[model samples]
Target: MTLVAYAGNLNNRANVWVSLLAEERRRRAVRAVAEQDHAAVWELVEAFMAFRSQSGVLTSVHTLRSYRTGVRQFLEYAAEHAVNVLRPGRDDAQRYINALVAGGKKVLTVRSRVAAAVTLYKALRWAEATEANPFEETFAPQDRMHALEKVPPYQERVVRRVLAAAQERIAQAQPDELDRATAVHTLLVVLAHGGLRIDEALNLEWKDIRLEDDELRLVVRSGKGRKSREVPLSRSAVEALRAYRALPRTRKHPPRKVFPFASRSSAMYHVRPLFDEHGVTDWRGFHALRKYMGSRLYENLEDFAAVAEVLGHANVNTTKAYVRVGNERARKVLRDW
Candidate 1:
């Protein structure tokens, strides 16, 4: 299925995905598929995979890969049961879900797998390979409200120790790795202090950073849903970015991208080891930093709107989770009682 032809069926979502892939990759994908039965299915799958590989724009790359993997597993299972993935009925979808649940997969895993199946079936429906999305009618878990999973922010001491260690690592970098070290160090500061998502940091451009008259602002040009917002930079975060920008390699010919890392995951490639070195095993990755930022902003300022604006949370409900009382603080108070 040619991209133009596929785009006609996919509504706007396919067009967005296609634009994210380079022209060469999009054309290559269109030409790569062989003429066969269910060729459209393969073409759509290839297109989705290509989009997953190249663009972490709309969703995290890790999530895209996981969804693709789940979809492929369902395809294999369908082949064994003589079910046509392109034309699955509700019963066929239910059986697959039952198989997953029977195998003792967690509710979240089962829901993710079913969601992947629904995504593919939607593509098939667009391709006119099926009359409807079979997986749409299938039962799946609905207990995934993020509020229930909320926890207290990391202890203030641990937060300080992690940021301090990041700076120490940058100071210790070898000559050849100075730029890389600066990049990681800047990311640590921005993520923890600025509260930006991993992708937002990775997608930041030189044009988005404004350092005028000693005031610093980072504009997120393309946040979730392509929304744009400008966040004030913490003084320390600004200092860290300045130090990174001043590196010899950076000054020589600044890359269009502000961060040196290629992708979101690659940006944090060094973070795991750093966390381990700091003896902080329980620390969640970037989200923990964001939560800490959100919590502090609310606790200090007592402004829901301000916290929401800075964190880029579309709903105040999401913002409210960050303000929940810290576990360590609660323990300390109870220790005296």
Candidate 2:
């Protein structure tokens, strides 16, 4: 389909702006290409990314940022080695893979960068800017590490320590610092109990939470890939949230958001020290908590589908990575045997 046709189908106000922006970027790229400008390659990359954005194929800011960085690295390598960005050969792709391996990049990192390069070629093909995709047959090295070894879930004891630390902070907080202390503690509680992504938890509003039949539940309006789902809150999570809500509001009219922090970094700023202090060093912030919830659910339910539903994973395969066999479970099984 033509770029105009692809963009024309969008009717929403936000998408209309995206379409216009993509069109402008495409025009600039086309002009640069016609003028034989060296900068045409970069313009084309921007236009391609804009097209992806307008098409709704790439929505996550983090993914877009990572892809841009990967693509830029590849472009720099191509320029240095006299490889044509517009029509790179398979040999060039292999050389790039070799360079990445030689640079001591992790297997996953190499794969991610290669995937980014492949996606860039796909964009170029969609834009009709290129007919070749050198990355089509290229492959990154295999990951030899076991799945559990890659990202192990936090043990129950460690999770308890983290929660205890948060609770202690709340208890010890002075009158003026109570609001922030409570918010941080509750944020961690929701992540641990609800199994929600950090972004999902951060985006939650007061309206999204519901109390039915004395059970607390959360409505995730938009999750990864724009999917929505309902998550049942654990008793501990509910209690923490209830305590947070009961705190006296400093402002007569406060924001409807569950947490007071605006950005992920802000949330982390309050909780990272707690996490580090309590032995959560390897995994990314907040995600380890989600994995902890997932592991516990799987251990109790023994059903992948049920755990997947709670975790809002569309594919059970993705859920598998989140569920780990805890030491306690292993010990129980051995003791029974």
Candidate 3:
């Protein structure tokens, strides 16, 4: 029976109808797998994502986008190589990984794509859509370097230079360009001080800013893993924000969001030139600012747990990766030895 007709007949039991619809989709997916229908299998992937969204298993749009990209890449590879994704042989996953490696994808990128495939198969199994688990035994190649070794935090001097460049742009901006300049500067200040993820900062509404007597804090309503935390703003950050808010353009009709850039890329377009002008060529973009904040906070507080709290890191170990040890400190310890 058509889903529409079935739903129409079960108007009284809407919940049951929904459940039946999901089961029907699962059955169709199973049939598609058995028939080796690539197009139908792609539809099943979409259905799996929809199911996760409906079930609140996936809350972040960024996460959904990443999963879609990774899964789509895998499916594309499978189709090109004439492999049935749902009925892959034992070596299919390894072959896919080998292809990615052959294409010179970074170790981290390869691992993330593999993880996305693994997640998709696990969800499909839970929904009874397919019994195939091609990626169950497959593993991505391990990176020889640790996270800290990969990208060190931006130095304090470099950060200061970038911030100064931003301030100069704000000062020299034309009347028509004043708002954009001020907004970018404020964003940089927040990133430098708040240690927030770029998404978290971009998503901030004016309501998230909490200002008390001589102090300022930002409320991140939805962070990684759908968690929420408050990060206290530094004195300089507070001043920058206040200055931005007091601008005639901002005061006339303040935007609902703190930074009114359309997307993350749009925001980066304004800030990236400043970074390039300065020698911060890590390519991590705004994240380097976050790492700078984490490292500075750890240096001052000397408390891993406290730094983790400020950075909204779930684990202290993750926070440690963000904090960089200075060469001078290492030299001092070695000299003592």
TM-score on alpha carbons, each prediction: 0.77, 0.80, 0.84
lDDT measured at residue 286 in model 2 versus the true structure, 0 to 100: 73
Q: Write the per-residue lDDT of candidate 1 for residues 59-175, one digit (tens) a residue.
A: 555566677777677777877787755445659989999999898887888988987777666554443445656765678756565542544566678788888887787789788
Provide the lowest-lDDT 10-residue window in model 2. 8-17
* Model 3 misplaced stretches (Cα beyond 4 Å): 1-24, 27-58, 123-129, 249-254, 333-337
What local distance difference test score does each model get?
Answer: 0.71, 0.76, 0.76
Off by over 4 Å in 2: 1-27, 30-58, 212-215, 248-254, 278-284, 326-331, 335-337
Candidate 3 lDDT, tens digit per residue, 110-199? 998997788668656755776889877886899988666677677888878888999999899998789888988889889888999889
What TM-score does candidate 3 get on C-alpha atoms?
A: 0.84
Per-residue C-alpha lDDT of model 2 across residues 130-219, encoded as one tens digit per residue: 677897777679998865567666778877888899999989999988888888889988988899988888889889897555657999
What is the full ranking by lDDT, best candidate first? 3, 2, 1
The order by descending TM-score is: 3, 2, 1
Q: Best-fitting candidate, measured by TM-score?
A: 3
Instruction: Itemize residue pairs with steric clashes in candidate 2.
Output: none
